[model samples]
Target: MSGVLEKIGQTQDKWFVFLDKLESRMHEICTAAVPEIREVFEQDRDPYKRAHGHLLMGLRGQINQMRSKANEVREEKIFQFIDGITSELPGHGFFTGSHDRLYTFRIACINRHNLFEEKIAFYMSLLNNAAGEQDLEAAYQEQLQAFEAIRDQFSCKQCAGQMTIPDLFFIATYVTCPFCQTQNTFIPSTGAQMVLHQARSLAEQRTAHLLKTYEESKPKNSLLYRQYLRSMFDEWNKIVPDMAEENEKFYQRLLQDHLNSINHY
Candidate 1:
């Protein structure tokens, strides 16, 4: 049972790594395609050319929607997989009650939340870029400002000696701070407030690492990047069998649901 538990722990680590790689590849595909897609729209002006341009835009939008659905499915699978492994391991109750398991789960949840936020940023960027290509300057500016504001808010919190309750609420708008035992109320900062410089630095480092991973995985040419992305999808499909069948079915249903919506649009 101990050996089985150890194997489950190892599997969790590998699955997380796989998710990281898959996400990096998806980002690479979208990032690389953006410029090409933009250029295609820019150089075409005739009615037929315009129609083709719209088709390309639709295709890109559909792909983006699919990617978002895929991420959601992946997140669900990740949590379910973690729970399953943790459930089956030896001395389940003891392990589940362990501080280490709790800490690991908390860390995983944080990382997953951050990844979801980043994916939202990525999608917004794509929309802004597309708007710019379409010469919708006003809409593009609106979205660009919104994205910048989000970045600034995060940056402001990081730079402050101590964040006010308002700032903490802004930084983590979705979750209550566990430290202050506060819910939706701002905690006042004292003059001698503790700095989160180390935590902020660590967060920045993780962002940089993710960016570096994407850069390294990116292909030098669009054709190659597209192929790499296709390969990743194939790999994921193959590995789904190794995962829980319920998770596999969930992802498939999610993909189909998203694709159906795209078709309707």
Candidate 2:
């Protein structure tokens, strides 16, 4: 009994020491990666988020490596010790004290692991939210104004007739010339192409107050969240009506995910 207790204490101490070192490593990784993430968010010109996507994938791989190390340590240091002790003293009379101490040690380890997971999640949230630092609404408006200014400057290729773009088109579209009765392919400017990429963010900004209202609710009002989501999608569809079908699917998925979170909570 005394031998088992001493071994358990030694294992717990080693486990805690490893966890402390791992936590410090996690902090260092997140601290070093945050500025890089923010820089990518601010400077990366690709609307497809290719650079940020690669960064996140690498970060996630590193975090997962740390998680794997933690689990391996737990299995080797804690589980092995417990299993060895249980087998060595199968019919011993030290079950009460040994079992109590083992249970406490296991709980402590679990709590530490959970805390590490939560910390990782927090760091990820901070990294992902860095993209919101840019003024998406202003970008959207600037692109919209630019598009409006040059919309009437296009000429038909077939007969050289004047053409007026009747709508905000992010991609190349066939524009029928009024005078020549010919189809002209209209391509938007490089700046105008960004509106489609940032439309959702702009809509979210426009409806941020409603989201705040929902978040501020005592129990987190689902109805308020639905109202906010509906308004946000409405604004998004308003900005890019051509994408309404795809946006509706995305909106439904978001709403379902929110509901799942609430239920799980």
Over 1-265, each residue of candidate 2 has an lDDT whose tens digit, in order, gives 7887887788777777887887788788888888888788777887666898889788878877988998888788777877777676656665577788878878887787788778778866766665556777777888878888998888889988878899888888888999978887888877777788788888988999999999999988999999999999999999899999999999999999989988997
Question: Model 1 over residues 101-171: C-alpha lDDT tens digits?
Answer: 53575477557646755764675467446524233333233433444554333212223332232232212
C-alpha RMSD values across all candidates: 27.7, 3.7
What are the lDDT scores of the predictions, listed in order?
A: 0.47, 0.83
> Using lDDT as the measure, which candidate wins?
2
Error of 1 at 137 (Å): 10
Q: Over the full model, what C-alpha lDDT does candidate 1 score relative to the true structure? A: 0.47
Ten residues in sequence with the least summed lDDT for candidate 2: 124-133
Which ranges in model 2 have alpha carbons more than 4 Å from their true place?
90-96, 130-134, 215-220, 241-265
TM-score of 1: 0.36
State the TM-score for model 2. 0.82
Q: Which pairs clash (backbone N, Cα, C closer than 3 Å) in model 1?
A: 165-186, 165-187
